[model samples]
Target: MLRLFSFGSGARLTMRTSEDAPLVICGHGMVAQRLIERLVALGHPFNGIVVFNAEPFSAYNRIQLSAVLANEIPEADLALKPQSWFARHKVSVFNHEPVTRIDTDRGTVTTAHGRVQAYSKLVLATGSRPSSLGISGEDLDGVLTFRTLADTRALINAASTHKRAVVIGGGFLGLEAAEGLRARGMAVTLLHRSDHLLNRQLDTTAGDMLKGLLAQRGLNILTGQSPAALLGKSRVAAVQLNDDTVMSTDLVVIATGITPNIDLARIAGLQCNKGICVDSRMRTSHPAVYALGECCQFGTHTFGLVEPGFQQAQVLAQHLCQTSEATEFSPGSIATRLKISGIPIFSCGRVQAGPATEDIQWQDRPEHRYGRLLVEQGQLVGAVLMGDTASGPWYADLIDSGRDISGYRDTIAFGQPYCEAAA
Candidate 1:
């Protein structure tokens, strides 16, 4: 039997069958929600599902957060599922309650509010936390990190009064934040410690092209610079750089990077390196306890992208539901698509070529378009497309399939259709 009672705003109490322990899930983010949805679709028993969400609201699309910050979409519109959906599925959700302690021996987890839940199986999807520069005055009122709906709201509120904004980090998230602030009618300056923007995803030439594109869109890009300290009395008013250069700003947004959330796993004595160590099946060091999403590491890889996490969720769901066709998790080349400032960009696999690799380049400078293919032994190893990304999927397919393109090398830079026509 299942019983439910309301406590207060966004808080709920539920009782499940004492006979079979429920499956306890921590962190109600996109990956966690996907797992729940997959289980429900597999016709898994609903009485076994219990979720702990630290956020006040249900799972939402974090990918659209930039739109929210730009005032293009309301926060309420980003929810992945409604409150009624949980009720319909008979899944108990304790909103605004985080699992503080995991007792593996006792097979239980305690919530922040002193509630204890027992579980036959546990899944950690705690996700990642925004990284800070560890500089002085980061705790100032105007210094913020873009990670959640709350953080977006804070930026929106700060932008209303602040005229100048400085965004730290030149990665995808930093660029998105800069663009969102620019869209809000604020003068934005982007600071990146690397020599080029998105150094991890793009080569130097591609990064330079992106910088030029963003500069044309009114973003001030400063590469090879890092913040030494944030200066303000009660709030941030300026940032001091490594070279002792101070730039004035009303608000500061840090989009440096993210650190995987692993405190709970560590406390529970689970094996952890950069993240919680999990097998290809998403099983943790403890059999009953499993992990997935950004908080879990499989082999040497930890995912920050949504596709890999979603794939892991599917595999874990199949395993948990005891599906007959369960498959082992196999990672593929991750692709990245930038969503900002109306600029189309796609990058996948190795953008940089090794000594033995062949590089094919096509540049249409007049149209601000560039494309490159990295080939090794007649197979497509990687690709980068900028300005026009219509052929991104085709390039990705070529890389994924490891197809031999020797015959089409002459016109391959023109993309798939042209290559096929030439063939």
Candidate 2:
């Protein structure tokens, strides 16, 4: 058995004797696994817990989807701490069970399998679904969204037959899909609505350079273009742009974006906007109920990335264990820098330059390298670097922590020696 807890300041927790404490966790995703581990470590035992997960496996690292799609790693390798992890922790896992509704009044949740269970405390960790472009022929056979293992397996099989493929969107997933498809011997045409790829994470100049590098690898990149419609009868045959120009294609991969899955929370009458709203403690609007990961929006920030989701889980676990206190999330403002196809791109804070912000840029034409730093009020507000972005983390850390770097401002830009006392 385990201990049952209630919501209150300095509330006493009752440890279970013969009867097990009823603590139900819905959605067995990344954040849920971490929370489960934390609960186990805290000596909290659950009584006949019901965990609903749509995926067949217990849990897995979703960030490796691109590596799986690229055939760099096997599907089984993506799995998180195996099924034994749940067994050892004494948690009843309901894999492939999608929860339909949660009854807040009765403190219970109903699954698609027609099972209803009571809970002392409930957790919502239902992840997100792939965004679809509202276009004709989207339901066609060859059109796909690479979000799950099934989707990646299908894409790998389709890649064998398709000589040419078009990817819609220019974000991390879209670029990964394009690179993976290219690795599979398919000519990939990346169609992006924005003028720059990874626009949300990189500046226009760095994005353009990344596009050029991708193009040099025989990947066709079409920027500032939106798909008017998918030109196909049954399976995908081609994709038509807004200019009415049709590109030959056999497969159309749409990586537009992802929308958080908050239907269950909404059905249960929980406060939700964009995602399930939670405070620093990961506590929802309802008492004794909590949420984490991409499904929950904290402090007007919804982190779609894995690292931040894991960080949120760690913070929430600490709160649940009564260890370290919870802190407010400052997502989207945090440092984001990652490599795409060996090209380094980094961005943090406000890269959008204006009169209030001083923009200092340096470009090495021969090396196809560019770096821009945005300074405001004696602080490094933003930065963007490409080709040679090894110092991305160094610069991003400066912006995130608001470290004083005015002394080395000029030297940092052009790889120059500091101007004597300015150092």
Q: Whose TM-score is greatest here? A: 1
Model 2, span 133-249: residue lDDT tens: 888879988999988888898899999887999999999889999999999999999999999999998788778878888899999999999998898778889898999999989
Clashes of 2: 0
Q: What is the C-alpha local distance difference test score of candidate 2?
A: 0.80
Shift in Å, residue 302, candidate 1: 1.3
Please give the lDDT score at residue 137 for candidate 1. 93
- Best by the lDDT measure: 1
| Per-residue lDDT of model 1, residues 37-62, tens digit only | 99999998535689998988788999
Each prediction's Cα lDDT score? 0.89, 0.80
Model 1 vs truth, CA RMSD? 3.8
Q: Please provide TM-scores, in order, for all candidate models, with all chains considered together.
A: 0.94, 0.88
